[model samples]
Target: MYRYNDFDEAFVRERVAQFSGQVARRIDGSLTEEEFRPLRLMNGLYLQLHAYMLRVAIPYGTLSSRQMDQLAHIAETYDRGYGHFTTRQNIQYNWPKLPDVPAILSDLADVQMHAIQTSGNTIRNVTADHFAGASADEVADPRPIAELIRQWSTDHPEFQFLPRKFKIAVSGAEADRAVVRAHDIGLVLRERAGTLGAEIIVGGGLGRTPMVGKTLKDFVPLQDLLPYLEATVSVWNLLGRRDNKYKARIKITVHEHGIEEIRARVEERFAQVKPAFGGIDMEMLSEIEAHFAPPAFVTKPVDAYTRAHEADPVFRAWADTNLAAHKAEGYAIVTVSLKKPGQTPGDASADQMRALAQIARDFAHDELRISHEQNVILPHVHKSDLPAIHAALKAADLATANIGLVSDIIACPGMDYCALATARSIPVAQGIATRFNELKLEHEIGPLKIKISGCINACGHHHVGHIGILGLDRAGVENYQITLGGDGTETTVIGERTGPGFAYDEIVPAIERLIAAYLELRTGPEETFLQTYRRLGMDPFKTALYPEKDAKAGKEKAHAA
Candidate 1:
């Protein structure tokens, strides 16, 4: 909840004015589409299949209730009556007219939000653990560091045109809810021998080639992190491939150079830049931290929450799935499921957005968070407010009890909206969610992550899901490929592909079969899907996914015998 100072206000207003002129130039035929492309992208505008898409950065996924209302207003006034919360902890307005983007940005600037650095070959939105400040088990809130990076990277002259787009994520909690390992620079804040520091992981990314980052340093003192990070990116900015855009990411650079060489180069660079920082970065970080100071937590009786949990099975189910333990006693973190069955995974209607804003203002601490999993979070809700919050969510049709369950899928806007996508992701996600809901087996399945991407860009983070589905166009047909054993937590693992792709129609049943196999193969109900997959490995799931191949192998083995 870092409020913009006068500098930030002036900066954003100036950009809005600048972009308004650029937009006007394009409309008046002074700028062609090619001429406008980079300008628009610099401002977080994309030409999607149907129209321009504007991605607004929600820095570290934190939002004030007033800001949320502003977003709702933008969704209702400038574009469609909904916004798609993306895996990058940002929101995309997909059908905005080119002429309206500057106005939308102006509205965002008024609320201390913007689309700046949400796109283009510069640092994207700096993300952090969604539960950063409120999680029960974090060393400290990491959003201040995230904000520091955001400030440092926003139009930084040196990194403005890196080889390719860069990303960074920070995790404050023991659990890596931010998918830190999948980012270009992943920082896990930890206290080491009385000094707060970060375990810096570098080179992690997901796209056509996915990688779990390698640890570059065991610990970088909190004060030196800015310099260390600058060195790392600067090294890559020089060494990263420019001839091939696909190989330009830092992950590829690290892969080619080896972590040791990269580490050596980064250390050398850090030494030169370390002195130049001169405590300025630390001063800025200190100011940012003050802005993120914890909200005043109120303590009260929780009898209403207990009564609702004991009396209503519906509320109980929701509480079981949608709530997380809070750092403050008698408080719970409520995840409002945007992935309601049969709807687009992250699309929140304008009314639902306003509803969440109101609920945040009334029942919670007037704060909201957008998780990378495409859910909205009420981070500091007292237990006594549970029933009322649930009722409000229910009224807005935002009450779904599936958080980590199978129906709570993370899906990218595949060919449905993305121009780069070869196959559809939304319908497949819908089909799977609807199918599992119909079977009423989501709760029984227990703690499964199903991520779907329309293409190999891994926008849905399919590479890290417990069960990942990657949609591709094989020949002229839509083909769906499955990957199992993937995880995005602290112990991150890239999923392994399961043989040939299935047809579009065959994908849902394939997922169902895999779940069925898990239900039967599990040691007990206590063992979750991920635990079972880790213990038993991918053979059983692969057999379940491709029964015909498994049967053929079995037949050949029998004949040989």
Candidate 2:
């Protein structure tokens, strides 16, 4: 994790003091809701359905146990007893009092954390693969680059305000766990000519106009990355649509103007500004890299772990599903699933947060990571500690053992919480998870990703889901639009929309029908729902979804009559 220096500390403290004064002015009637709106938003505070929600940035989703403890303390003291982890790997407290926000920010600053750039139309938190440092397949740790970007973008005078929110994600591993393709800017670390570089993918996003990013540059050398990134954002900042909020995202800009034109503009900007970098950014990156050095690992035998796995089926199942490939021998990246049946997806209670912090301190080399799917990861847990860690997590209800399964859903706070939402998403997610669990079909369904967004903003990443569900409003009635064949992986693809939307009541059964169709049509058990849907088209699933409609016209007429 990147520690805050004196400058960083002073900057945050000053921001906190500024917000504190703003809060006082609002309370004392000097600032009206209209006047105070942007100020609050800039500080990562939002007035949601029932209360004020405070979103705190977990930069690149990396945190120390002490930082986790601070978050837990904030949750306990300032807001509700629990916090919601979002798809961007940030955490949101849905019930913070307006007056206490500055205090909350102060607590976060105490731990070298803040809510800056977690919201608003500025460069949002720069995310990366949760398993960046620990993943065995990684070419390099993406955190150093992520941190560099973070420093460059934080309160960046040039980019303080953009047409819309900007997001950047970096991935060093072969698997795109960071969902880079769905971001405004995506960087894939690669090696070329025996030197490290990045494949820059730009203008990808997942709002109403979802798009997989186009490759702007095949290989940008390490030295040129910051300049290139600055150029890219500068181009978008100057030329991106400002007339309409919906059209303002770089995704639409890229869609409207061809990638070649955008590339040309970025190149021109880069050529002009590249000289200003003067290699200082590289030295800063190297300093950041020094902070992220890997922790020492013990050469421990895993015979005990093998014996435990052989003895306990439940532990074995958990190990198989939740453990990811680790870079160190006998070490595993453990994903703690937040998706327990009937619970709000991506929510962790204060106690659960504290417990996870304890686990990180005791067993995970004091390193904790938050995955983009809204789960926590203990990035360097020894295999021998698996049994104990599993037991503790199971006690906290964090060990659901559903990593990529159907039950591991990503959902947004819909009508139940989000004022912008027209339809509910959380309940629908719970319904699907509960129905699947009741049917005992989750395991049989195999690896499947189902993402639900409350609205077209695509906060839950519905566009990249293998099965995407978007909640919508149709003449004041709740409805859902389904999209299939989407994937959030290295081979990223935005889901294609199926015809018309379904009624809210009919969505769960519709999803069940889709899964059942996949089961029936799949060539083998190894084929995932997305794979099957890609091989075969929507027609097969459409038939299953509307069996009565698929019948003859006469039969349909008879039934209707």
Candidate 3:
């Protein structure tokens, strides 16, 4: 995890002081809502449907046990008893009093955390794969680079007010767990010519216009990353559409002008600015890398773990699903599923948060990670500690034993909280998860990702799910549009929209039909929903989803006969 230095500490304290004054003014009626809107947004405070929500950034989704404890304390003291982890790997308190926001920010700063850039149209939190440094297939840890980017982008004069919110994700591993292709900018660390480099993907985003980012630079050398990134964002800042908020994302800009044009402009800017970023930036990167050195590990035998797995079915199931491949032989990356049945997806209670902190301290070298799918991870838990950790997590309701299962959904707070939402999303997600669990078919249906968004903003990343559901308003009622064959993995691709949208009541049933169609059409059990869908196409699922229309069409043909 990245530790805050004196500069970071001083900056946060100054900001807290500034915000404290702002809060006082607002409470005293000197600053109206309109006057204080931008100030509040910069501090990650939002006036939601019922109350003010405070979003705190977990930079690159890394946290220490102490930091986790601090978050738990905030959840218990400031707002409700729980905090909702988001797709961007940040946490949101859905109910914080307007006046208490500065206090909450102060509490966060105490643990070297803050809500800065968690909202607003600036560069939001730089996210990375949960299993970053520990993943078996990683070429390099991306967090150090992500942290460097965070430093560069934070309060950057040129980018503080962009056309719209910008997101950046980095993945060190080959598996692409961070959903890099769905972000505004994606960095995949790779090795070329015996040197570490990055594969830069630009303008990939999910919103009103979803796009799988184009490869801007196939391999950007480590020394040139910041300069190239600055150039890319600067180009977008200058040329990106600002006339309409809906079309302000870089995705729209890339779509309108094409990737070739965007790439050429970025390259031109990079060439012009490369000279300014010399040895000074390189030295700074080395300093940042030193801060991210791996913690010491104790070698331990895990033969007992193998025996325990053989003896316990529940442990075996959890081991199979919840644990990920780690670079270390005796260590594992454990994903704590936030999607427990009947609970809100991505939410962790204060007690649960504290329990996770304890687990990290006791078994995970005090290291924690937050996945892009809204789950917390103990990135370096020893295999021998799995059973005990699982037991503790179960008690805290943090152990759902469903890491990649269908019930593990990513959903944004829709009409329930977000003012920009056109329809409800969370309830629909909960309904789908419940229905699937009731059927006991989630396991049978392997590796299915269902993402729901309140609106076209794609905050929930609906466009990249194996099954994407986007909520909208149709005739004063909630409706959903479905997309198929979308993937947020190494082989990134944008999903194609299926025909018509379904009403709110019909959405879950439509998803069920689609899954059933996949089950029927799959070649074998090993074939996942996405593989089957890609193989068979949407025609079959389309017929099942709108069976009545298909049947009526058949009857019309018969009448013609």
Candidate 4:
């Protein structure tokens, strides 16, 4: 939770005033839709299929309870009753009126938040591990570096308009919760010989062309990160394609020119820019680090927590699924699930947001985090507070014990909201979650990630799900394609597609068949779907998906042989 200084306060207020005038001009016909597109996009406003959507950045996914309350207020007053949390750890208000955007932004500014750089073909929100300071296995908190990058990149003269939007993710933990491999620039903090630095991974992205980022620099000292990043983005900004918007991303640039050449160019540019950074970045990072110091953890008995776990099966189930080990002795990290059965994957109602805020204030350390998995996190909840927190969440309908389960899916706002989508995604996700819940096999099925995207944009990150579902329009009918064995972790891999697409009506049953096949093929109940898929490969799942075709092909191959 980095608090805004005097300069930050003035800067954001100035930008709000600037955008307010821009908005007025658009409404007054001084600026047409064509003219206002870039300006509005720069402010994180989008004209969606039905209404305008505003994406507000949650830097490093950290928020104070006060800030959370402000967001809830914005949702209740300006937009609809709920807000959608995105895969980037940002939040979207889908029903804001054109005239009310400035007011909404003003409210955000009051809370030291803004929508700048959340959209546009510039460096979007700099994301980090949601459990940055609270996780037990972290080398160090990555938020200070993330904040430094944010301050440096916001309104940088050289990078205001790149060839395409760029993303950067940082993770400090041994486990890759941030999915850094799928970003344009992924930084994994590492310590060698008692000194901290980062391992840089470049060119990773997912869309029509999915790639796991290749290692660019094995280790870069913390002090030199900014200069090195400047080198990387400057090289791509100039070399990336401008002719076709589709191929304008830095990922495409890295694909065309190998990593070696890119490294050479970046090194050449690094020498030129390294002098300008002359320790100011380090000074600022030091200042930013102070704002992120860990909360004073209180020592408390866990007798109540143990009793609740032993006595109440419901509380125990929720705790087992939703809780993670914290760095502090008595504290635990709690993930508040937004993917309740049949609801949108990442949406939180205004009341739910308020409830979470109150719970954070009372039971937690007044801190909240938005995980990239589309869930809210109370990162410093004492174990003794678990029973009360669980009761409050249950009252708000936020007590779903499905974290990392089959029903806890990640899906994008497809044809329902996005204009670029070719088919519907929300309904498909709802159908899948509801179907699995009805079957009561989610816990039995074990940990699984099912990501869905309405199109090739891969906003839902389907390319990295254990079971990836991509919805497309096949001859005006909705069709879904499946990819298996995709993972977004330290050992990241793009999913492999199973043969053909299934009709919308057939997609859920097709998923069921795949799961059934996995259960049968696994060595035992402990072997998860992903493990079975990796051990046995896609042939079995494909055969399950297209039984008649697989059998016919097998007979044809036998006859030919």
Candidate 5:
């Protein structure tokens, strides 16, 4: 919601001009691909398997109606007619011409958006809770802090080329919707003694070495936040491994050097850095906070929503799945599902974008949010507008009553698009969603998260799913590995892998068997898969995954008995 000031506008314009020149040189063969790789990457351009992919950052995942219109325009004009929303709360264009990327950036600049730092080994987009300003449970909105960090880190000379890409996420609520623990720097907003501060976490990451971040500081006063973060990442930028790409993430560095040592070093560095800040960061934050003030609320009766829920079972089901509690009276946060059955997860067409923009403008206060789950959010919709919003979504094929159900899967553009991927992720996710839809058991399963990644690089965040599926090319065959009991919430943990990987064709049935086991093993439906898994541990799910082993054990037990 923060509009670009004149300086911000000039900065983006210069970046676009520079990148346009670089791209033109590359096209003319004056600069080879090898020479242009880093430059292109810094601008969020990647050469995928088939074409160039452009990732545009949605800072803090907040969007205005005008920005949404610009995005739709980009989808229709530049690349394909659709864009893929990523788990990082960004959007990607899989097919774009080399010459047109500059134009794309210009269009984004028109709406106060950009692709800078969306890629490269620099500080990426600073993400925050999608419901930051509206969540009923929030202590304070964290996007102002996220936006502050974004301003500080963009093209920061010291961190432009670190050991690896660094990510930061902020969680404003008690529920941890932003997966703060899985980030390089995770900040949890809290207040004590009438003073606002953050619980600072460091060295958490997924990819090859999965780690839940350790508490770097129990509380960093809001004034001292940027200084503390600078010291932390600066330490990692120096101490992190540059020799091995696989071990370059801060998580690996934290693993190699104990958290205590890292903490001591960071503290020493913070001591030096703290004085230089002199509270300017806090001054900036006060200004940023004003931009995120809650929209003006209009009192409205919920009679229409109650009537629709009572009269129409379909509307009731959708309302139940798609809505979240809002801080304001007579308001609800509506999640528009992108994971419709048999469709690629998170692919939104130009028409869908425009429709969502219209919904945000007419019903929700001209505001929209992109969620880390790859869904669209209308954060301040009146309860009375629920039926109309649902109807519009239904007409656009966006109304899928499956937000936290098994069918609401998070998947990456695996081998289908990413050259780094070893196997395809989209097909596997689609197969699982289609299978579960046919079984009609997803709603019964209740709040199951299935995340699929193409490789160990975890673009889909597979390590944090309740049921995680990792696709790999094993000896020339596509193999799928399953991990159970993973969570990406306030209680974050990396999932445990089941015994062996399954073939591409066998993965769907394997998931089905695991769900069936949970259905039978649970004490009641109220106990979700995660709770039952925690209660019963891995034996049940592991046995279900490997039926042959289960049968062999069963036969041996019978003989012994």
Candidate 6:
């Protein structure tokens, strides 16, 4: 965890002061809703369907126990005693009063946190693999460079406003846990010529026109990274479309102007700006790396964990699903599932938040991570602490043995909260999870991702789920559309949409039918939904969803491919 320096502290405090005045002016009738919209968005405040929502940035999803405690405090003291962790690895307060926002921000600033750049047409929070520092397979922790980009982009006058919101994700592992391919800018850290460099990926995004990022540069030396990024954003800033908001993202720009031409322009810009970055970022990177040094580990006997797994079926199930390999010996990374059945996905109550904070402080290092999947991660929990941690989480109703399973669905706060939403997403997600839970077919179904979005904004990343569900309003009725074989990992691909949409009542049954069809059509229990879909293509899934349209255009395309 990087502590804030004087400059950092002064920066947050100044922003808080600035926003406080903005809020005051808006309240006192000096500014109208129209006038304050951009100002509020800049401060991470959104007037949602029901109430104002405040999104706070958790840089690279890392948080100290003390900072977690403060978040817990905010949830309890203000709002509704709960907070929603988002796919961006940020947290949103659904009901913060207008007057109290500044105070809440001040509290966040006290812990060296803020909501700056979490919204609006600016570089939002730079995200990375939640398992970055702790993953055994990582080439290096990506936080140092993620922090470097954060520092560089924060209020960088040149990029204060872009045609659309820009996102950057970095992953240090061969496995793309950060959904790097779906970001506006993706960086994969790898060794080139005996030195750590990055593979820069550009113009990948999901919204209306989803695209897997294209490689901009195969290998950018660590020192040249800042300059390369400078060129990338500069090129996009100048050439990206401003005529239509829908065609504003760099992904569309890259598509319209071929990637080769864009690459050429970026190279030209790189030649000019590369001279200005005289290793200042490299020095800063070194300082940032020191703060992320690994925590000291004591080799603990795994006898207790082995015994628990051998004796307790429930404990074994949770451990198998929720645990990942840690870099240190005798330790495992624990993913605290927020997708408990019948609960809102990615939401943790204040008590649950405090429980996790306490568990992190006592059992693991005083560190926690917010994963892009909207789960809390205890990144360095010793194996010996398994039973106790599980017990505590179980008591809190957080011990759901479904990390990548059906019940662990990803969904957005749709019409239930988001004003931009045409249909309700949470209800649809709840319906699917509850249906599967009642059927008791989740674990048997194997690893599956069901992502739902209220609209085509793709806030829930429906385009990348193994089973993607998009909610839409059709002629005053709620309709749900489905897509198959979408994935967000290294083998990234946009899902194929099944022909036709189902009514709200028909959506849940539609999903059930799809899953049932998969079970019968799959090679065996060993074949996962995505694996089966990929191996056989969309023919079977489409037949399952739309038998009448089986030999239609979708089938033709599937058959042709």
Q: List the residue pairs that clash in candidate 6.
A: none
TM-score of 6: 0.97
Q: What's the lDDT for all of these models?
A: 0.94, 0.92, 0.90, 0.94, 0.93, 0.93
The digit string of per-residue lDDT tens for model 3 on 83-140 reads 9999989999999988788888888899999999988999999999888888889889
Q: What overall lDDT, based on C-alpha atoms, would model 5 receive against the true structure? A: 0.93
Candidate that beats the other on TM-score, 1 or 6, i.e. the better one: 1
Tally clashes: model 2. 0
Backbone steric clashes in candidate 6, count: 0
Better of 1 and 3 by TM-score: 1
Q: Could you tell me which 10 consecutive residues in candidate 1 have the lowest summed lDDT?
A: 541-550
After superposition, which runs of candidate 5 have C-alpha atoms over 4 Å from their true positions?
Answer: 554-561
TM-score of each: 0.99, 0.98, 0.98, 0.98, 0.98, 0.97
Tens digit of per-residue lDDT, candidate 2, span 1-561: 788889999999999999999999999999999999999989899999999999999999999999999998999998779999998889999999888888899889889999988888999999999998999999999999999999999999999889999999999988899999889999999999899999999989888788899999999999999999999999999988999998999999999888999999999999999999999999999899999999998998998799999999999989999998888888999999999877899999999999999999999989899999989999998999999999999888788988999989999999899989988999999999999989987878889999999898889899999999999999999999998888999999988887788898899999998898899999989998988988888889878877776787558789899
In candidate 2, position 269 carries an lDDT of 98
Query: Where does candidate 1 stray beyond 4 Å?
Result: 553-561
The whole-model C-alpha lDDT of candidate 1 against the native structure comes to 0.94
For candidate 2, the C-alpha RMSD (Å) to the true structure equals 1.7
Task: Kindly indicate the candidate among 4 and 5 with the higher lDDT.
Answer: 4
Against the hidden true structure, what lDDT does model 2 obtain?
0.92
| Per-candidate RMSD, Å | 1.1, 1.7, 1.3, 1.2, 1.2, 3.1
lDDT for each residue of candidate 6 in 45-148, tens digit (9 for 90 to 100) = 99998889999999999998889989999999889999999999999999999999999999999999999999999999999999988999999889999999
User: Better model by TM-score, 2 or 4?
Assistant: 4
